[model samples]
Target: MIRIEPRQSSSALMTYGIPVLSAIISLLLASIPLTFSGAPIGASYFEMFKGVFGSKFAFSEMLTRATPLIFTGLAVALAFRARLWNIGAEGQLYLGAMAAVAVGTGVFDVPGVILIPMIMVMGCVAGATGMAVPTLLKTKFGADEVVTTLLLNFIILIFLQYMLEGPFKDPMGLGWPQSSPILDQGMLPPLMDRMRIHSGLIIALICAITAQFMLARSVWGLKLRAIGENPSAARHAGIRVNRTLMSAAIISGALAGMAGVSEVAGLKGYLTSDLSPGFGYTGIVVAMLAGLSPLGVVAAAIFIASVFVGADSMSRAMGVSSYLADLVVSTSLLCVLVGGFVARFKFVRLIQKKEVTQ
Candidate 1:
């Protein structure tokens, strides 16, 4: 007979080591698909690395891709830390982008100093409102937040589509499904002379640092961790579990909303239905890869961004499908999940003997 047993204490080394090991294993597994596709596994990987880090332009583009991921990853990380399965970050991101578009398209004619902050705040508010429904459903009606949030994502996507095809559609775009271009004042200024990287990167870094500080040094963070570990025990200890969870949900949503804002104001300069290439969904993987650490999220996001950017280069150079990047990412996520499980528990063969007294 075989039995699964939880370890009394998990190894600290394994806890951190699993992510790296999983990544390596994922790469090895990914080589199978590469071979089947008639691509040189080693060469493909080499090209990917060279594309991401070999040139200044490539590095800048990678940073731009990492920017929004940082926000989305932080959003997922914060909620997961509180044991809240907030899966509506995708919806929240779209709503945020919508709000930013509304504000950036001369909803107000303020200067950049005022307009920029206004757009960001509006985006954050929109995101928070999107999450409010799921939070309330879970807190007041005993509904599952996971279902509510995930469903909300589809709903928001449809809503965004409706807006873009109707009220927010740009007449100058020749019937394209996109919003009007953001005015200069509402746009994020580029960080470099030639690169498209913008101030959003700074904002993402600041948010990550702030989140890390809150999680590590604040009383509220302590309460949140306590609640995540055991809500019943936390309630018995006089903690307001519902309120804290609600706060977490709102903050998480707000962070995700910022990702949308960053994309519209910093990169595309306009809102579109396809502004995100599944950044919100990918963020769950990023957060997990970071072990839910806010600071670690930065590194994880950069690494993920590099994979996608490099994959694009590889595809262009080696006649491979760009979907290979998605495959590797998905495989890495699976490896991380399995590695975490193995790290936490062990399987043992149980020896049994017939009862002699019978």
Candidate 2:
């Protein structure tokens, strides 16, 4: 009989080497699709590399793409740490974008300093409320959070569509299904005048650093990790499980909502259904790649963003399908998951021996 057994300790190799190894594998896997598309594998990869790091503009685009990813990644990491399955971050992101538009689209007459804060606050609240509904269902009615949260994404998307198409649509948009542009004063300033990179990148980094610090040094962090590792033990030790979970969920949702704020105020300066490009769902991948570490999420987000940006560049240059990006990302995620599983468990073959004395 073969049996799988849990590992008693974390593997340093798995922790340190897997990401590097997974990255290499992800790059190598691109060759398969390149061959299928009749593209020169070597030149395709070169273009990808160039797109990500060869030019200043390419690098800036990668960072720009990473901004919202960092926020959503942190959200997933924090929630997963507390065993909260918050699959509705996509919806929360839309809610946040919607809220920002409501406030930043001439709804407030205040200065950017005040108007910006209001926009961010409303976004955070909207995101928190999005997660709160599912959390409440899980806690109060024993409903499955995975189901509720996943379903809520559709509800929120439809609501956003209605708002944009009917109530919030820009009259001057020429029939486009998008909201009015956010006021100029409400926009986040650029990091550099000639680049698309904005102050939002700084905000994302600060949030990542702050989250890491909290997870490392704070009491709530201790409770969160403890509950994540073993909720029964945490409860026996007098920790309030439900309360901690609720707080974590709120923080997670708030972080995700902030992604919406970043996109609207910093990048697009407007709200639309296409604002996210699935950043919320991709954040789950980033969190998993980072092993649920807040700081690691930064690196993971950048890496994923690079892959996407590079893939787009490569696709355009090589005349191949853009879906190659998804293929590579999915492959990378699978490798990491398989590596993690190997790190956490081992299989043993049991040999039965018969007594000769019989």
| lDDT for position 225 in model 1 | 90
Error of 2 at 103 (Å): 0.5
Task: Please tell me which predicted candidate would have the highest TM-score against the true structure.
Answer: 2
By summed lDDT, the worst window of 10 consecutive residues in model 1 runs over: 22-31
Compute the lDDT of residue 344 as modeled in candidate 1: 84
**Model 1, range 30-148, lDDT digits (tens) per residue?**
77888888998899989988889989999999999999999999999999998999888888999999999998897798899999999999999999888877999999999999999
lDDT of each: 0.91, 0.91
lDDT of 2 by residue, 179-238 (tens): 999999898889987998999899899999999999989999999999999999999999
- Which regions in candidate 2 have their CA more than 4 angstroms from the true location? 1-5, 346-358
